[model samples]
Target: MIKEKAKKKWDLTRKMLEITDDEYNGVTQEDANLRFIKTKLQIAVYYLRMLDEHNCEYEVPWNKEQFKWLLRKPAGDTKKQKAKDWCHQCCLIRDKACASWSYEEATA
Candidate 1:
């Protein structure tokens, strides 16, 4: 179930990024935004898959600092805040998935 959710998010983000790329007319801000989102989705998919396989030896794509940055407040703009909120939701899903794993055995 977690894998399927991650896959769906990745697929949707990829489609959005493609559309943004196709409509590119020298403006890069939108393209960059979508690219960032796509990257996050890709990482989520990877981590979720590894979790499904019970692979706990692998390191996370983002370190503690980077993940904290991803969830930080976006200055004072509503648009940026919305993006942060979406990222937080993604993190929650990944965190819940991680909690389902048996780390005790993996560490032993």
Candidate 2:
């Protein structure tokens, strides 16, 4: 069951990458390419953090991509604060059951 849940989370992560890639349109294709790559790295970091909190055994490794993503600060202070808040929310919900879970888990 844990493996199945993990697979679904991974699939959702990949879908997010696809959505972001499709949404990317920058000054140059190279710029969009880099943004897309960085977004994927960010998603990977998000997923890894989730897995870590769950004590899940997975092969995803720490790399420079994740490091660069962490180092990047949004241009505007509001944007930076929003990003920080979002990460905090993700952390808060790590142990909680998904809203889409069956009623038993959802109600528990």
Tens-digit lDDT track of model 1 for 21-76:
44344345654454455455445545545554553333345554654454333312
Report the Cα lDDT for residue 103, model 1.
58
| Clashes by residue pair, model 1 | none
Q: In model 1, which range of ten residues has the least summed lDDT? A: 70-79
| Candidate 2 Cα outliers beyond 4 Å, as residue runs | 1-25, 65-108
Name the candidate that leads on lDDT: 1
lDDT of 2 by residue, 1-108 (tens): 365565665664445444343336556644444454555445545655566545545454434464445334332343344435444444445434343334345564
Instruction: Provide backbone clash counts, one per model.
Output: 0, 0
lDDT score of residue 68 within candidate 1:
47
C-alpha lDDT (0 to 100) for residue 93 of candidate 1: 57
Tell me the deviation in Å of residue 46 in model 1. Answer: 7.4
| lDDT over C-alpha atoms for residue 92 of model 2 | 41
RMSD of 1: 10.2
The superposed Cα distance between candidate 2 and the true structure at residue 104, in angstroms, equals 6.4
Error of 2 at 52 (Å): 1.4
